[model samples]
Target: MENQEVLQQILKELQSVNQRLDKLEAGQGELKDNQANIENKLDSVVEQTVDLKEFKTETNNKLDTVVEKIGAIEAVTKENLYDIAKLKLIK
Candidate 1:
């Protein structure tokens, strides 16, 4: 009778241990899912930052080109005015 009681007690302890292990596994799964979501959001933020930097560089290049063209037009206009002044003096 004593041996039978000991065996039954051991079986009950094993069942309790198994139940705790199941709860721990469920908690671990939730942590993994949360980590995956955070990684995805971080990737999106990095991509947007790269796109913004490229747009700023392109706009600056276009502005530099426009300034160069305006300088050239001013130089030509000054040369034309000097030629006209000489013609008036001869007449």
Candidate 2:
């Protein structure tokens, strides 16, 4: 009867340990899933950052083009004014 009691106590202890292990396993699984989710979000952010950099470069290039066009127009206007002055003197 004493041996049976000891056996029953051992079984109870084993059951308790099994329950703890099950809870720990469940927690570890959840942690892994959360880590994956975080990594996916990070990847999306990185992609967006790259796109923003590309857009900034394109905008700067367009601004440079506009500045160049304005310079050319100014030069042409100056030449036209000089020609008009010369024509008026001839008249």
What are the models' TM-scores? 0.60, 0.74
Which ten-residue region of model 1 has the weakest summed lDDT? 11-20
lDDT of 2 by residue, 1-91 (tens): 9999999999999999999999999999999999999999999999999999999999999999999999999999999999999999999
Give the range of the ten consecutive residues with the poorest summed lDDT in model 2: 80-89
Q: Which stretches of candidate 2 lie over 4 Å from their true place?
A: 77-91
Task: Estimate every model's Cα lDDT from 0 to 1.
Answer: 0.94, 1.00
- Please estimate how well model 2 matches the true structure, expressed as its whole-model Cα lDDT: 1.00
Q: Give the TM-score of candidate 1.
A: 0.60
> Cα miss at 40, model 2 (Å)?
1.1
lDDT string, candidate 1, 1-91, tens digits: 9999999999899999999999999999999999999999999999999999999999999999999999999999999999999999999
